[model samples]
Target: MARTRIIEIDPLTRVEGHGKVTIHLDDHNNVDEARLHIVEFRGFERFILGRLYWEVPVIVQRLCGICPVSHHLAASKAMDSIVGVDCLTPTAEKMRRLMHYGQIMQSNVLHFFHLSSPDLLFGFESEVEKRNIFGIIEAYPELAVKGIKMRKFGQEVIRATAGKKIHGTSAIPGGVNKNLSLAERDHLLQDIEQMIEWAQEAVAIAEGYCVDHLSLVQQFATFNSSHMSLVREDGAMDLYHGVLRAIDASGNVIFDQVDYRDFNDYLMEEVRSWSYMKFPFIKRRGNLDGWYRVGPLSRMNTAGFIDTPLADDAHQAFRAFAGGRPNQMSLAYHWARMIEVLHCVEKIRQLLHDPDLQGSDLLLRGERREEGIGVLEAPRGTLFHHYRVDNNDQVTFCNLIVATTNNNEAMNRAITQVAKAHLSSQKTIPEGMLNKIEVAVRAYDPCLSCATHALGRMPLDVALYDAAGNLLEHRVKDGR
Candidate 1:
């Protein structure tokens, strides 16, 4: 008889914030099950009740240091809709899209190279002694340097748009808080040209590694799941804006225009007894049931056309994965991210060079009611922010549906697969497996802090439970 083995990872780090994962194994050294759990969300949704409408942008943006802009936009878009300020003008729309692209470009680079690359680049079975950022830098200096450049480029875009590298004061309820000058636009253009050159090299670096290490994609790409993203009617990806659409691996459109308010349609959220975060699923069609994958992988699958050259080439390469159509693969997230980054750089270059970008077409505007929804293609996946206003138009409610939340199903399953495959036989799994599971979560670049504080916060202890009613784990965290 095989004895039961349990290996758990707590407090996933090295990206945005904290998370946890646990896996179970059988005596035969096979993974029996896997669970991805997140502890310590202070119920931000409950906390955001009763605040001014205009404050929604500022308050929601505080959800996470790394992804404040997403929150800011989600809330702003929702609020704009509520107040009927639909005419945000083309220039404002272009600028916002430009900034949104930057978020995707930078965050994807960080996840693949800094967080997930360690295990793939250095064999997962290799000694843990030399599998960190410093080690990667020492051994693969070019890749490491590319990672740095990509990250810096992202931050620079954020700084130029929102006035802060991490969080920005602009992107308010109705309109942006600031405008740009011709010189500033010129500078942004120049920077984008340089970044595009660098991105070309970065792409080569990834392709080289990926080609030489086909096993990385082959192994990690196991398992197929449904994909989802926001897109225009013509099936082009709409990063900063659009309606939600989900597509299956067989090139079938599973769902479309899922009303932001009716997200409950074709989607369901199930609470795991072991974690505070809720797992989401596609309202299964027949036997194709259960939660689905989101973020970069999903976005690429859902998108039918590529607008940028590099992204288009990558997309074609991806289609070659199966029957000249994109098949489900976890590592496709890396591919999708690079494609998006390419699109972002090229788009930004065009927008910056445009004559309208240099003018002060942008103007600050306030709103009567602040309650709103901000939605954006966060690097990880579809991110949504919803808000409500009180009598005085103060914030009465804030709810966030973040990117990681979108990939909870896939992240949990992938961790379980790895644990089953690699750690089932061991009496005790290495701390590295725990970290690896966490790395899987970060591969989505989830902004946990922002998610927990999305609705609002109150102090609470998170508890995990099993079928027998045993307490598996528990942790406490504060809400901001």
Candidate 2:
């Protein structure tokens, strides 16, 4: 009789979600199947149903520490649409874009150096402790310092442009609450320059990895579908807000730019019973064939071209690998992240230089309650926050579409692929492969807190079983 094997991760820690992964393998080295599950339900929608209109941003920003800007922008956006007024003037619009650029820079850099770099530079066999950002502190301190400085400088811009570092209250229904003082502007520019230098060094280091590890790229870059992102009809990178456009896997442009109302017509969410997260794909293409990815690579693929100069250069380098198509391998996320970092710096510099950004009045105060939706390119991907308010300015409906939700189908497919590739009979059942599969999902850097808002912590029970259904191992995880 051949031995049966199962790998289970119950209640994954150090990240969002009561998440788990299960892998089952048959005797004779055949891999049967795998699943990625998101447990627990918090009715964030129900919690906000009766709240005041302006309280939306305040309430939703607490969804996740990693992508609070996404929630804040989305919630506020829904209000903007509902009220039927685009409150921000040219200056306010510029400032909001700058704030959002800072968010994109910090978030993309965090994923690059902290989460994904360890797997790229150090062998997966490297000690788990030494395989994180701290590992870089031990083995390659200068590179690690560059990463830290990059993140800090980007966050400093965020703090100065907005109010708080993580959860900020500057964005409002009509406009922003904060103004850009002269001193703060100078401080922001200085930080932007420093961020530029640090990002350049980080890019060089990543390029080294790209050059040295061809095989890793080959396995990690497998593309399953085409890509999508928000951009202008003229083909410029639209950061703060724009229409959504996507291309099929064959490189044919599907829809150049589609407005949000038509969002459901072109792209729709596929409800899956296995996970709370919904898979987003082009409506007509169907599920298995249509699931496209977002975040770094997809954003790079979908945009007609990048606007900023240095970012354009980096983008040129990225295109040299595989031009105008999805790189597919999750490792390519770094290349996309670096391109965006450069893009953020250059565009922010342009925005600051604009005369409008220096004006005194920052907001246009007014209240008009109507159905509205605000769509912006969150650091991870396109974020949609829709809201409906009654005549009394009370919120009645709220719907949020986050970036992670865009990649749900792909993540499941990836888990199963990783299982088949590495969990066969001849392969060793390593202790941390479950975490590795989960890490693949984290490559998208999901913000779970933004998905919902009600409060409930649930316990976890992970059970391993053989093909015949006999129990092999069981473990329970502590709930919050």
Candidate 3:
């Protein structure tokens, strides 16, 4: 009889919050199963009840410090429909778009340079202590400086558009609370050219990295799945606003121009015993057959074209590597992320030139409706915020499908694939093999804090089971 063993990685390092990986081995030491588990829970949906509709935007922004602007704007958009406005003032719309672009720029750079770059710059098997931003700075000081300055420029843009960078109160029901002043606009423009140059360079570096590691990019947690994102009427990528679009693994359009309110018609959520995060799937395909992905890779695959000229050219080069198929390579997420950062820089420059950004018509007063649904493409992916109000304008029901939750099923599937590829039939699992599994999870850039919405301290615990379902090993990390 063959002996069985298990491998567990607790509190996946360099991620946003607490999560774990558990790989079960069979009698033959073959990989039996793998799971990515979210261990925390936050009941934001239940706690928001009885609050005023307008307060929802402010309260929900506390979901995650990294992407608070996404929740802030998504909640504000939902409240806008409740207040009976179909469209915001020209200035309000432009200002909100600017703020959103800044959020995306900063977020993309943070992930590419601070969180994920270590894996790319240093070998995946490099020393854990040395695989970090400081290491990158020591080796390539110029590139590190550029990334820092680029992120700083994005944060400054956010501060200029909104009152502050994180948890800003600029977006409100029906419109924004403030507009961008002429001086503020001019100040932001000062670094636009340099930001664009840095973004373009980043894209080239990412593309080169993908090319250099072509084999790893092709095989690392790569599999076929459906892709989803919001797109303009012409099928151009629109991060701030658009209709929902989904495509299958073969690049066939599954659905297009979907309204946010009618999302229930095509999407459904499944609760898993192993995870606090809900798995979302396409209703038409059912649970097992309906798993889809969101975020940079999904967004790049679903859209027909990027509107910005420079980014559009870069996008074409990105597609050429896939040979006209949906880019299913999971590692290419880094490439897609850099492309998005380029698009955000170009979009920000264009919006800064618009005179409407300086207009004084900031707010619109209106009556309340019984319900409202707000949807927008966040830095991670599509984010949904729905709310129902009582006669007194108090919230009665709230539902939020965060970006990380939408990709939960896909992430688990990817983890299983990585475990099978690297750990199956192995008598001794190396630390590098475990790091590869974490790399699969990191590729998705999941935000567990936002996905679980949990309060209090978070801890990650991973337990491995033998073929007889006996706990063989356990690893735990206290996130507090």
lDDT of each: 0.66, 0.71, 0.87
Assess candidate 2 and give its lDDT: 0.71
lDDT string, candidate 3, 1-480, tens digits? 665666666768666767777787777777877888887788899989999988999899899888888999999989998998878999999999999999999988998998788889887888866777889899889999999999988898889877897888889999998888889989989999999999999999999999999998999889999999999979999998889999999999899989877888999999999888999999999999898999999998988999999999989999898987899988899999999999999999999999999899998867768889888888888899989999998999999999989989888888899888888877665656777877888888888888888544334455666656677666665544
The list of candidate 3 runs beyond 4 A from truth reads 1-5, 455-480
Alpha-carbon RMSD of each model: 4.6, 3.0, 1.9
TM-score of 1: 0.87
Highest-scoring model, lDDT: 3
Q: Give residue 353's error in model 1 in angstroms.
A: 1.0
Clashes of each: 24, 14, 3
* lDDT measured at residue 205 in model 2 versus the true structure, 0 to 100: 66
How well is each residue in 1-480 modelled by candidate 2, as lDDT tens digits?
Answer: 775666566664334445666777777656677766666556666778988988889888777676677788777766766555565687767777878888888888887777677766776556666666778778888878877778887787778777888988888876677767778788777766777777776666666676677686667526567678788767777777777888877668887768865676777777777667677778788876777877777887777678887887777777667754556767676777778888888887887677776776766655575687777788777777777788888888877777767766666677777767765664554545544664565566654444433233323345667767787777655544
Structural similarity to truth (TM-score) of each candidate: 0.87, 0.91, 0.96
* Worst lDDT 10-window in candidate 1: 454-463
The candidate with the higher TM-score, 1 or 3, is 3
When 1 and 3 are scored with lDDT, the better candidate is 3
